[model samples]
Target: MEGECIHIRRLTEGSMSYGNFYWEFIKTNTPVIVTGVSIKWECSNWLLKHGQENNIYSSEINFDYLKQQIGDRLVVVTKCSTHDESTVSVEMQFHEFLNYWRNQILSSKADVNNVTAPKILYLKDWHLKAQLPNYEFYKVPQYFASDWLNEYLEEHKLDDYRFVYMGPKNSWTPLHIDVFGSYSWSTNIYGRKKWILLPPGEQFKLLGPRGSLPCNIKEEMLIEKSVNFLIIYQHENETLFVPSGWYHQVLNVTDTISVNHNWFNGTNIKYIWCNITENLRKVMNEILEFRQYVNFKEDCQQILKCNFGLNISDFLEILCFIANSRLTLYMKRYRSKDMSGNRKSVNSHPDNFHIHYDLKSINMLSKFIAQDKIVFNCSTLYDRCMNLIDITQEIFLER
Candidate 1:
């Protein structure tokens, strides 16, 4: 069977009014495909064949069985329902699965459990440790990492980023944005997938109780047209470049596999990191402030703005200043003399001013400041330090 043909168009000089058309898309928040570039087929085939041969039946797997199958280097996480009678299942990392199947034969233990229903699964970066299993199965990286993408990355000076993702079927990554401060182009090297994207300003409600780990919003709410941008495909060898700050959820439609590269060559890189750091602070504050509040989602959205700035890089230095100031305050509280040495003593204060920092975190903050990539005026940094110290002293004296 053949896939749908996508229109290809070369973006020549003065093709579309670059300023008007491009900026409009950013302003209106719409996704577009820049045609004319060729797609990669070899890498896609290699991935598909790898999955077909080594991917295990989701139903018949257990932690112990997988450990024996893949050996000790695997990181396995099992998601169980809150209800007692619910069935148990597991998801294994891609590298671990490959190590196990490469040396061993088909085992009888896999047949013991009736591996029936299919659940959401995710495998991250399976190819780093192993070469593409078979070239005939899917397109190779050489196809997509062509002159077009390479030239684009170079023109934008985005060569510093790394591409590290490997995974198999039944493993689905949670809905989230790309990491390491850049836009991402995710191409399906193996199977079909369903992608749901939430643009800036969309409110995605949380799935778990307030302050749960692996924070995720309900999938059902993501389907509403008013709240999400949805795309579904099968056996489609295409690349989708998602702009920075877009919230996305991906599901493997078959025993499929994929590879994605996140790059940070543009000004948007700094902004993306800023957005992530600010969001983390907001989440931590919400968890601390309203441990009792059930509607934490609404509260968080209220304070955040939809458009952080023109692009991620635009506000990189400023956001770094905010982040550094916050971290310094956290460190001062930990080193203060007034507080009892016990860590618990810091939390008993009525002002809710408790903060903590460790050596590794402090070192990282200092490095960012020293790089000058995140420049802060001397007065601003000094003011932040004094305020943090005063806040700590006040909290301790009140206690």
Candidate 2:
């Protein structure tokens, strides 16, 4: 099957209100390149140096400053090679990677396209926020503050979805979806990146006969197949919002530093629920012979976590936390309603809209999952979720 090309919209900071953004991009599940939003971020100022290249101003990350801050910290580095699927990774101190980065830069400068031995090392998924809690690098923009995954993780002091990625030119990640089918936003602190993004479901077409997807996509393949995708050149200080389930491949066009987070909110919670259920089905099928065991459901949940990083119980806890929090806001807002018999559209209050929208979305998923006895086997949690949903509807919907 032939596919058409896709164009991603670009928006300036303050160009559109959060309401319009939520509807146009979030609700519609579209990709967008948002500029000017990260210009004033602290990291943008302190960690980068202003320079002019080809008569255009640009920001480059300061290697010296980065080393001073966290050079001794441990980091994971992936070694990528040209046309290779067996990428090896190692854990080393940050300073070691920096030394490698410096050497690679010098080598590339000497021979831009013909370097015989180039080290394509990428440092990714560094939990910088967890390590330096007091350091205020960049604040989460209001438009993305409804991140349930990070909010729950932060509140429980477990872990965060936020990450810092640094890689030299020629480093790239293969085509894949984000964890739990969550929406992801990546902001470039410095340098440029080339992103190849395919809309949801298009990736399945690229799968091989045995259900294996290529680790690295070839330019010839995209040309022969006429695959529909957006080729975005993300410049410095720009943020890219990738909607849920979108398959993307990122290559560092220049040595780049970026912060990325994977999160899901009411806008994409259905995708998260779908991902969990699909994985649950696969787990059950893999262990079909043991289905009659008394601990069958528990065993499935355990294996689900081991394989997919989340299970039914973990999902239910997240749902309850989000549902109860939204219910509290709804009740608080209900108490503050105008006493003069005046009412307004839900859209008039962004917070109120979020409360109502998130609660309704959560309730829909919770209700559906509650009926699945094989996966959602916890009776106590089910009752609590249903009670919360009932209270949410009674308190918010009536108004």
Best by lDDT: 2
Kindly list the per-residue Cα lDDT of model 2 for residues 1-399, writing each as its tens digit. 456667778888668777777778878888998887677877775355557788877555577887876658888898887775678999989888988888878787889677486768899888899889887787776567679899888888887899989998888887788999999999988888999888777777788999998878765676566677778999887889999988888999989888889999987887798898899899989999998999887898899998988887787788778888877776666557631211243335567667767777787776776676653457766786677567656654565
Tell me, by TM-score, which candidate is best: 2
Compared with the true structure, the alpha-carbon lDDT of candidate 2 equals 0.79
Q: Rate the local accuracy (lDDT) of all candidates.
A: 0.40, 0.79
What's the C-alpha lDDT at position 40 in model 1?
A: 42
Stretches > 4 Å off in candidate 2: 46-55, 338-349, 373-378
For candidate 1, the per-residue lDDT at 379 reads 48
TM-scores for all predictions: 0.43, 0.92
Query: Where does the lowest 10-residue lDDT sum fall in candidate 2?
Result: 338-347
State the lDDT of candidate 1 residue by residue for 1-399, as single tens digits.
Answer: 112222222232234443343334422435443332224443322322223335541221233533343344444433322222132445565455544433221332354463643332234533332332232333323212211223343344544233323333434556666653346666654455666655544533333366432324344544432344445353334555566667766655544544465543222433554655466455548566675687554444443334322222223333333334434754565444443424344234311121322222223333453344222334454344344344434433543
